[model samples]
Target: MSTVSHALTDSATMLRRNLKRMVRYPSMTLQLIGMPIVFLLLFVYVFGGTLGAGLGGVSGGRAEYVNYVTPAIILMTITAAVQGTTISIAMDMTEGIVDRFRTMAIARVSVLTGHVIGSLIQTMLSIAAVIGVALLIGFRPSAGPGDWLALIGVLVMMAFAFIWLSVAFGLASKTVESSSNVGMPLLLLPFLGSGFVPTDSMPTVLRWFAEYQPFTPLIETLRGLLMGTPVGNNAVIAVGWCVVIALGGYLWSKKLFNRESTR
Candidate 1:
């Protein structure tokens, strides 16, 4: 077979292996999906009234808050899903699975690509679940069909970028536990951004940080798509960040994987 064909075949096999592992060990995936849903329910039912009331131009209610917060929650879902990728990659590393693969004749990149693709699939599913729950809880988006399609594209791009970063994290960690810990920032970043409330309401320093952070643009772009708020240049900025992150992560992961394989 040709080189590209061999690579594709190996990658498909590796993806199937990861998917089967996910099916057999489903708890982690479930937890990844559940955490965001809990946050959704908690914020919408618990703090939504006060928070929604605080928005500048929106009516004050839980229903209104759901619309604003759902985008953040969706972003969080992707972040949380990558945590599983880290764990899975770490497991393969620490358990000598990658070592076994190294001795075989297959595309070297397929090992990492399998984890990336599988995690992306899992992340998208988690996003879908979160959005479903958001809708059930009165999170109504104003997006038309075209807007919804754009939203999906933005989300896929975001997930792809983060999953690669997680792969790098997993490769960097020496232990599965450390791999899990390293990705915690991904989960907390949404909260530090414009996730729960308007950035303008934050104190000056924090507001500046929130405004400038990567998550803020991604969240704002999502909000603009779903709520019809002005997107401005947020879409371009968000895409730029995704590209940088994905490229950096891919390079780092490849370097780490090759270094380890040689050792």
Candidate 2:
């Protein structure tokens, strides 16, 4: 087979392997899914009334808070899903599986590609679950089919960027524990942005950070598409950030993988 054909076949095989592993050992994925669900319930039912009231124009009700918070929660789901990617990659490295693969004649990049594609699929499922829960809990969106498609595009871009970053974290770490630690910032960032609350309501310093941070633009773009809010330049900014991060992370991950394989 030609080099490209070999790479494609190897990647497909490895992708299937990783996906089966995900299905067989589902604890991590379940935990990731469960975290967002807990957050959704806690914020919407427990704190939604007061938080919703605090927003300038919206009615201080659980329903309004639910709508406002769903996009943030969706972002959180992606963050959580990527944690699995880091852990899986780290484990594969530390357990000598990568070394075993190196001795094989398969395309080298296929290993990483498998992890990336599998993780993306799992993250998409998790995102779908979160959105379903949000809909069930009175989180109404005004988006039509076109808006939903746009929303999915934004989310896929975000996932692509973050998954590559997670792969780099995995390759850089010496242990699965360290990989988990490195990936934590992905989960924590949503709170620091406009996810749970409005950036305008935050103090000046934090407000500034929240406004400029990558997640803010993503959240705002999602909100615009789903809630019918004015998107302005947020869609452009979000896509730009995704492209930058994806490129940086892809390059970093490849460098790390090559270095480790050489060692």
Candidate 3:
């Protein structure tokens, strides 16, 4: 096969194997599914009403509070997928699975690409489910097709960035504990972003952070796509973030793999 064909074939094979492993551990699938759903219900029911009033009632009343928060939370589900990537990669390192792969003829990059692609596919499903629930609860995006497509483009780009981020953790970790260290900040992000509330409601300092954070652009871009509203200047910023992080991660991971192989 041509190099491109070979890479594609290897990536598919790797994805299938990883997915089979995901199936065997049904709980892994459950956590990915259940965790996002639970958060959706909690935020929409418990906090949505109060937060809606605070946003000047975006959906018009306390009853429609669920609509506005849906997109933010849906995008937030990637946190689970990305963090899961880090731990799984870490486990492979700790158990010597990755080291063993080095002795085989398998494509070196496929090992990372497969898991990243798998996680992205899983995250897409979770995002879809969250959207479905949001629609059922009366949320709808007014954004047109092109805008929606742009939203997905940014999301997929963000996924690539995060996958590389996960790979770096995988490369650096000597233990499983060390691998999972990116958790706290990722989980707390929705609270900090326009996820459940607008940036204006936050204190000046936090609003500044929230306004300037890379995630804010991502969330806004997604919000415009889903809600059919304008995302303002977030489009440029979001794409820029994706490019910088993905390139940086690729360069770092390439070097790390070379050293590990030489050892």
- In candidate 2 the C-alpha lDDT for residue 261 amounts to 73
Candidate 1 per-residue lDDT, tens place, 56-126, comes to 45566897899999999999999999999999899999999889998899999899888889998999999
Deviation from native of the Cα of residue 196 in model 1, angstroms: 0.7
Clash pairs detected, candidate 2: none
Candidate 2 C-alpha lDDT tens digits along 227-262: 988999999999999999999999999999998878
Order the candidates by TM-score, highest first: 1, 2, 3
Per-model TM-score versus the true fold: 0.98, 0.98, 0.91
Clash counts for the predictions, in order: 0, 0, 5
Task: Report the alpha-carbon TM-score of model 3 versus the true structure.
Answer: 0.91
On TM-score, the stronger of 1 and 2 is 1
Worst 10 residues of 3 by lDDT: 56-65
Q: In candidate 2, which residue ranges exceed 4 Å CA deviation?
A: 56-59
Cα RMSD of all models vs. native, in order, equals 0.9, 1.0, 2.0
Model 1 CA deviation exceeding 4 Å by range: 56-58
